[model samples]
Target: MEHVYIGLGSNLADPAEQLRNAVQALGQLPDSVLVGVSAFYQSDSLLPGQPRYTNAVVALDSDLAPLALLDALQAIEIDQGRERHERWGPRTLDLDILLFGDRLIDEPRLKVPHYHMQARPFVLYPLAELAPVDLQLADGRTLKALLADCPFVGLERLPH
Candidate 1:
């Protein structure tokens, strides 16, 4: 199985429950196993005027290919009442493939190591909790280093 990291975020419909439910749903993916999950973090929205978000990272061991895994994640979002009314808009559930087994992918519908994960504390902080300390980014920085420079500092770890 390939090691995969997924980022989860929700700002609508009981955001905390949405994250917990998403983690459970991820465990049910065919040929996949949920490995680890970080404590949920609350952060201000990336876009002004939007609600704060509940965010976390999940580690998985999966046999599914990257695209298939992406499809599964999108399916979970849709199943949980997600709507694409706006770009980076508030959502009921958002699941992003942050990293897929050290593989880099650039596709029309998906990007691995998620394009903006490195720069966003909402993603990086929770990810740091789950990812290996030595995990390297595309820019050749370690996850620890990336966390040091993450500009978004509003993240507050939520209770278990």
Candidate 2:
């Protein structure tokens, strides 16, 4: 099994509930075991005029191949009413493959060590909670270094 981290976000239709439902679905993925989940956080949307997003990170150990895992995640998003109407637009659920083991992947449909993760506090902070202090990305960047660069700003930790 490979260690994987997934980033979850939602801004429409009761965001927190959406994340909760997504988490449950993640736990049921075939050939995967949901290991850890960080606390939920509320953060401003990437684009202005959109509702705040509820976000969290989950750790999974899966035997499934990377593309297969991505497919399963997309299926879960669709099942939860996700619509790709616009780039960075609001959605009921958004699941991203933040990291897939220590592999650096670049496929037409997927990119591991997710492109913009190092700079997003909503991604970094929650990831810090579940990742090791010495965690290193496939790209040679350390999780601790990334956290140092990305401060926890414009984010609110919701009660569990």
Candidate 3:
């Protein structure tokens, strides 16, 4: 099984519940088993003047191909009322495949490690939690070193 990381977020109605439902949907996918999840986090929106977002990371063991996993994620988002209007726009749900066992791929539709994941504290914080055992840096640098340098001022760990 290939270990994969996914970034989860919701800013629409019932954002917390929406995130919970997404985790459930992801757990039920064929050829995939939910391994663990990071604590939920609250962060300012990437888009200005938008509602704050609830973010989390999910660790999974999956046999699905990267593109196929992307398709599944798209379906999950659409089911939760996600619509793409502008870049970095708001959404009911957002699921991003962050990594696939260190393999790198660049396609018009996809980029391994998700193009901008490294720079986003919302994503990096949760990812660091989900895989605290090893800092698997998408960059050659260590995840531990990266975490130390990140200033996710707007991010806070939610109460359990």
Candidate 4:
């Protein structure tokens, strides 16, 4: 089984509840075991005029292939009322496969290590909680180094 990290976010329809439900759904995935989940966090929307988002990271060990896993995540998003109307627009839920073990994937439909993860505080801080202190991406960047460059700004940790 390959260890994977998933990033979850929501800003519509009771954001926090959406994440909780998503976590439950993740635990039920076939050939996958949900391992760790970070504390929920609230962060300002990347785009102005949108509601702040609730985000968290989850760790999973799965035997499923990368593309198959991506498909599952997308299906979960759709099942939770996700719509594909705009780029980075507000949504009922957003689930992303942030990292897939130590493998580097560059598929047309998905990118491992998530292309913008190193620069997004919402992704980095929550990920830091579940990832190993010496975690290194397939691209050779260390999690500790990424955290040093990314500041925890515009984010609030919600009570568990």
> Worst ten-residue run, lDDT, model 1?
137-146
Model 3 residue runs over 4 Å out of place are none
Clashing pairs in 4: none
The alpha-carbon root-mean-square deviation between model 3 and the true structure, to one decimal in Å, is 1.4
True-structure lDDT of candidate 4: 0.96
Better of 2 and 3 by TM-score: 2
Judged by whole-model lDDT over C-alpha atoms, candidate 2 comes out at 0.96
| Poorly placed runs, candidate 2 (over 4 Å) | none
Alpha-carbon RMSD, each predicted model: 1.3, 0.6, 1.4, 0.5
What value does the lDDT take at residue 149 in candidate 1?
Answer: 81
lDDT of each: 0.90, 0.96, 0.86, 0.96
Q: Over all chains combined, what TM-score does candidate 3 have?
A: 0.93
Q: Per-residue alpha-carbon lDDT of model 3 for 50-110, expressed as tens digits?
A: 9999999999999999999999999999998889997687789999988887777687888
Question: Model 1 over residues 1-160: C-alpha lDDT tens digits?
Answer: 9999999999999999999999999999999999999999999998999899999999999999999999999999999999999888999999999888878788999887698777899999888788878888654668888877886578888999
Arrange candidates, best lDDT first.
Answer: 4, 2, 1, 3
Model 3: colliding residue pairs: none
How many clashing pairs per prediction, in order? Answer: 0, 0, 0, 0
Error of 1 at 27 (Å): 0.5
